[model samples]
Target: MLGIGIVLSIFGLGFFCWLLFTLAVYALPFLAGLTAGLAALQSGAGVIGGLVVGFFAGGATLALGQMAFATTRKPVIRIIIGLLYAVPATVAGYQVSFALAGIGMSSGGWQTAFAVIGAVLSGCTAFSRMTLLVPPPDGQGTGGAYSLADERLHDQRH
Candidate 1:
C-alpha cells in the first residue's frame, strides 16, 4: 500500500507539472486576477463584485499583452514582451526548485544551482509558448517554415 501510494503521488505530481507547463501562458494573468480579487474583497467589495472586477482586469491585461505581441514587428520590442511573459514561469520555477531542494538536498550552492536551472527551463518554456510563431499567409516563404527543402537549403547556406 505504501508503494502504491508513492507511485500514485508521483503520477499526480507529473500530471500537475504537465498541466502547469501547458498553461504557463495564463499563469501571470491568473495571478494578477487572484491578487486583485483578494484585495477587492478585503476592501469591502462584495464577493461577486470583486470576482467580476478581477476577471475583467485579468482578461484585459492578457489581451493587451497578446495584441502587443501580435502587432509588433520589431524584434527588440517583441523580445522585451516575451521576457515579460516569462516572468511568472521563472518565479514559479525558482519556488519549485527551492521546495525540491529543501526536501532532501543541502541548502547552499546546490539549491541555488537547481533554482537557476529551473528558472531557465521554465522561462524558455513560457517564452516559446507565449510567443508562438504564426506561419506567413499564402504559403509565402518567410524562413520560418519547416520543410525538407527548407532544411536542405538552410544546411547548404551554412
Candidate 2:
C-alpha cells in the first residue's frame, strides 16, 4: 500500500509539471503579441506594424500567463497580474541592453538583453506559481519531520 501510494504521488507530480509546461508554452507568445500590436496601433503603424507589435506582445503575454495562473483561480485576474509583472521587466531589458551596448546599441544587443530579461522574468513567474501551489501550514502535516501524530497513527508496534 505504501509503495502504491508513493508511485501514484510521483505520477501525479509528473502530470502537473507537464501541464504547467504546456500552459507556459502557449501563454507567453500570446501576451507578447498582444502588447506589441497595441503598441504599433497606438504609434500609428499599419497592419504590418501591428503584426510586429503582436510578435513582442505574444512573448509578454506568455510570461504573464504563466505567473497569473500560478496562484490564482481567476484567469482574468491572473492575466492582468501577469501583464503587470511582465511589462516592466520587458522595458528594463530593452533599456539595459541599450545602455550596456552604448547609447547607439545595435538591434542585436537589444535582442540579447530582451532574452535575458524575459528568462529572468519567467523564472519569477514560476516561483510565484510554486508559492501559490504550496499547501498552507495546516496542510503541510508534521512540518516535514517525523511527528508524534505519525507515530500514533501509523507506526507499527512490534
What are the TM-scores, per candidate, against the unseen true structure? Answer: 0.74, 0.28
Q: For model 2, how does the per-residue alpha-carbon lDDT over 59-80 read when each residue is reduced to its tens digit? A: 6565555555565656577656
Model 1 regions lying over 4 Å from their true place: 104-108, 133-158
Model 1 residue 139 distance off true place after TM-score fit, in angstroms:
7.3
* lDDT tens digits by residue: candidate 1, 1-158: 99998898778767756765676677688888888988898899989989987898789878888888878778789888888878887888777766765655776788888778877777788888867753344444554465657888999999
Poorest lDDT segment (10 consecutive residues) of candidate 1: 134-143
Q: lDDT: which candidate is best?
A: 1
Best by TM-score: 1
Candidate 1 pairs with clashing backbones = none
